[model samples]
Target chain A: MYTRQNQKNLTSAQRKRFVAAVLELKRNGTYDEFVRTHDRYFVPDDEDGLRVGHMSPSFFPWHRRYLLDFERALRDLDPTVSVPYWDWTTDRSPASSLWGEDFMGGTGRGPDRKVDTGPFAHDRGNWEITVGVTEARYLTRNLGRPHKPITLPTAEELKWAIDEPAYDVSPWDSRASGSFRNKLEGWARNGAERWSNHNKVHQWIGGHMTGGTAPNDPVFWLHHAFVDLIWDRWQARHPGSGYLPAAPLDRWDRQRGRVLTRDDPMPPWNVTPAQLMSHKGIYRYEV
Target chain B: MRPYPTRCNPRTAAAVLTRRAVLRTVFTAGVVSATAAALAPVFRSRRTVAPAATPGPRPAPLFEETYRGRHISAAPAADGSRGGLDVRIDGRPLHVMRRADGSYLSGVNHFESFDSPLDLARAAVDELGSVRLAAAPAHHG
Candidate 1:
């Protein structure tokens, strides 16, 4: 079992080892495959397949399990490593040294490549990219009916089309693209409303099924993680937002028309939220 | 259920401690026949009570003006759980769950719209009295 001590207090050497393990997972296809196959990991519940557009109560527990799975994969590769969380609160400036190119792919500065230290520096507010009619049309054609698209795109397809390359008209390029800032705005202003709509359909499907139209996308987990992270940050700032007390935990039970749960055993890797709460036993992002 | 102890005299405390130790030993021996008999039925009866389901009518969104002067006044439950006030705002119902950990969770519009769970929980403690639990339906089972 991972302990809080091991994760909460990571050594410099451990950080290097942890980053290397992440890169290794990225290379060996393990990370990509897990994101693709795991129902709770990267599956979105919307027409456009936007993962963060809305989230369910199961969101936190699901990512908690996914990150733990990644951590375990890392440990299996190297026993001595531990995960670290990035406390974005402590370092609000986008130019904070933590984002250095040596860690994430971008140059450790703002999107403009200049050293920035304001709230907008790492500010995700302006990073949002709207799913306008043009992109939405392309996505609808390629993805087919939102309820049951022709086929779920591979993570490679999703990554290349949306995250990696510029938008093109190819039928293969079905998702939207834009800066992270624009997406954040879309989420803030319309996130709850959009999520409520998407969740209604998702809950109708009972929350679990692979190979459907939108849920099939592999970008789901990363997208939701960012959503979950946003909610986390929002809660930190507002401190009064949350699910209703009567917001039935029953809705969270995968057996009760929802696809995931706080305790559901994710396939090919059987783990649960009870196990992930501890910092020591699992791998986590450096928050 | 039963109020066990608020305070104990040294003599009674010592005797209680000794009794607890003795009970632990006796428990291993399976010899506390009468005590076990007294506890079993209570446990069984508790299992028979229906679990509480999520409440309803869904709370409507509370305007910032609604919470301007509210302050929590009641002490928390012994177990650290908090009690909340349910209030009707423009004919809509809201339920807030507050706990002593300085955290709360509230449901707006019965339970349809949820704010951040942790924030709602904290708000419950901060905004008591301003709200009141809606009357339980008269025909509840």
Candidate 2:
């Protein structure tokens, strides 16, 4: 569905139309106002009464609906416009022309911006080495299997690792929550040194689990696209992520908590991943 | 019958017909006069109208230096190094890096994911503290 090779290639006319569409939605009060109202999508169980693991199985569906709504807003503004996907895999190296000035703003040189050269060059003393460590440990123990500790790679290696398919790892496990909680506690009791180890682990698994919610980092989208691509690749490789049996208790439509039976209507809008993979049309990025 | 009708006929019919014609004329004149007065401003305004084609403000530069690649954009930071605060979203740590040119970049985990760099930065600032500018690394090839 992505037509353009690069966002820079988007015409001024297209950008104007897209902006107009988004503005129109905002003017009409049709835009998602959640950013103003809520702090985050999933509140940590420890901080808020909100249960961490209690997010509905329909989380994916809800996000899909939200994104489609935004896409519809864009389409309403200009029917010719399509949402562009970032292909991080092809532009694996930081030295490629892909990192040019017209693209990401910086001193106009180097992968990570030099501190003295441009705007926003400093470390925002705000980096909570502690929180970073704690989170890193939680993910490692839960999503990753026990292995010999690995060293954090250079920034270039980190970038390379994001797209490497050989690093594919499973994020969910049967005992993920407990393990995550235990790791959190261990990291908390320990000092910054303990946290540093967590940071290393964070970098390692982070490069592997390329698709999670980390949008602030420029690499987040590319990583996630690869992650999504991996899922697609997996289906192509293994046929499916496994299917839910057609049972009375299996609710395919999680929002409504309604069970999906064989006889039930499977509308195109509410297509299951299995159904999505089965369609003859599949998306692949043009390198 | 002819003698009785003769008394009521000619004089009264002539007077009534005259009054009706006068009233109709006056009413037509009043309506026409009012319409002309009402439309007078429109004609005056049209004559004083300014040129139809004035230039609009120039469009914003076609491309923002901040964004790189097809979907990539740089986040700005004060420190020489583009690195800013990092945060965890849905169990992932996002490194908020600023470019030397003053744009920003943060990692996104999915193709269809809706998180933006600004979103991630704001979250980091919210969780950690405001960003402090750091020294740019000495070795930038």
Candidate 3:
């Protein structure tokens, strides 16, 4: 089993190897497929269709598998390279080492929002937005969206989601309040803040990170690694609460075929949520 | 149901260019031209005119507006993702997806889902502010 470490803790060599492997994937076109898959799965519940990647109870497990598959892909290129998590709660600024010139690079500059700095910068010719299933042909970001500056999710905010006992509830989707899945997925739209936790981090990264085709930016892996880590933490906090909708939804329900129940097989992989409920042997997150 | 083309001139070419890009990625040039011809009526009002006589009451089009100086147009997504609307801000594409709860989301203001594509587009314009959107789109999916 491998352990996912925090980005801030990675040795310069480990970071270099990981970055190299990612660039390799981008060069050979495997990376674009990852972007495409994420875009394909970015279905919303209102579409009332096959929604697995987000806005549903499967948010945690689905991403767990997606991240795992991505890690495996990277390992194929370099066994020593493991995806590192970016703990937005701590290493939160655009200037952090996570965005250092030697690593993921800094935010977009100028009016076009082109990320001129970074290995993935368009001028670098290594990471063009090819299969993002998106419009931006080059990597772009507006860190903190300066005009409307938003911060990375705070530790306190994450605590609110991890503390929720129920893994998910009936009518399992973004609006399903009290469900740990939606809370951590950051779909709560009431009160002062409309976006929280996971969603807030994406918002703070703006540009390519702002939509379903977020993988266009390499930080997507680090950000999602942290999200996956949060899920692991949530699981440890509420061990008794398991994946929800233990059985399938009623046939009459509109979401019956769309939302994956505990045992339902997620498409593109056919793996059940129950099967991915644990990462004890597959991988572990280092705080 | 697929989204029809949104009304506007220059924006139509941008949307068409995006559609053409997606078609070239996934379909043949013949299909691309056919699609362009099909959508031609939306912008090419001089040709392919609609009938004066119609059926039952027509529903108000869901997306067609200029929010905060950014012109957004909605049409059926060429990729055929469910409830996926092919929207463009100014002359650049603004991809919008429908969530299970009937809200809208896009990469520009990606964190939260808005009530409709228009709301989502407006929020994206607000988030984008003065930054101009890069032209053209890709269909790597």
Candidate 4:
């Protein structure tokens, strides 16, 4: 299986190939379609369009399948390209080399905060946004301008989240108070500090990365890859912990008539959480 | 037929028979009138109306309207409670719910809390922006 490597660890050649393959996807219109699909789900007006991939236990599986699809698309163009994971906790600043012209690109500029340098820059004409815009057409990033000083979770904080006894707690959602998933997802906060993790990173990135179609930014892959890596780590730590709300357990069908169960097929994909619990046949992350 | 009251001739008997026929006709006419009055409303209503029209879909709100021009802020609370900070958007509580685990959840999206109100508000703005143009008529081109 192709291994997903830390973005900071990628060799110069590997980084170049990854960048080129992403450009190729954008050039072919496949990338924008992915962005559009994600946008549709997150902001669906109908009951069927609730954010199933988010605010629920399906978060991990949905994103895992989604990332796999994207990776496969990239590999189709360049067999060597694999999506890289960005350990934001290690970098923690806008000045990271990952934002240089050679890699993903730098922070955005004024007026609209659109990036002026890098492969995905509007000047390059390859990363134009085909979806999720009403007036402006370029990708944007304010990069900590619109929020507090950007910071990533510390090792201790991550350990605290991973050490929980259960994968999820009652409610099993963003509102779940005692859930490791909620804590890691950045919704569960300690005391009154507010939840701060995945959500914080997205806000820290700013611009298009903050939006539902954040995948429009190539960094979106790196960010999510790392998130998946954390989930993998959590699974390893709690070997006995399986997905919550097991089958035969009834959860009212807010979207449809059927009650939700672990075995129930996740919409927009044919897979279930049980199927995605392990990375066995799919791919592995390079530690 | 009784042959009694022979003195009572055929003329009086015929008159009595005519009176009984007139009374029967009046009673039959009254019944018909009463039945028409009772049934008139149902037929009249049916003729004038059709089955209720199915409600058209309700339109989604505009992105700008979600907050109602309210600014979101997250800052340390003055009360000095253990909660650290208060998050408010549009001058209303935003990420105010404290879970049993001590993590904060936003009432806005019921998602994770932000490190600051600014962070939380930014997420809310991004979420609101995700609304498709068809749903957000004001933003439509």
Candidate 2 has a DockQ of 0.03
> What are the per-model DockQ values?
0.01, 0.03, 0.20, 0.03
TM-score, predicted candidate 1 vs. hidden true structure: 0.32
Best by DockQ: 3
**Which portions of model 4 show Cα errors greater than 4 Å?**
A43-51, A251-260, B1-141
Q: Which stretches of candidate 1 lie over 4 Å from their true place?
A: A1-12, A37-54, A108-256, A259-287, B1-141
Worst 10 residues of 2 chain A by lDDT: A137-146
Q: Write the per-residue lDDT of candidate 1 for residues A178-201, one digit (tens) a residue.
A: 312112222212233321212222
TM-score of each: 0.32, 0.33, 0.80, 0.68
- Here the TM-score of candidate 3's chain B is 0.49
Q: Per-prediction fnat values?
A: 0.00, 0.07, 0.46, 0.04
**Tens digit per residue, CA lDDT, model 3, A1-287:** 88889999999998889989999998888998888888777766655367788878888888889988999999999888788999999988777999998799898876567788878888888987865433557787889988678888888888888889999986787888988888888987435888798888888888778766788889999989988888888888988889988987754454677788989999889999999988888778886
> Tens digit of lDDT per residue, candidate 1, span B100-140?
12123233211112243334433332322223323331110
lDDT score of residue A115 within candidate 3: 88
Candidate 4 TM-score versus the reference: 0.68
Recovery fraction of native interface contacts for candidate 2: 0.07
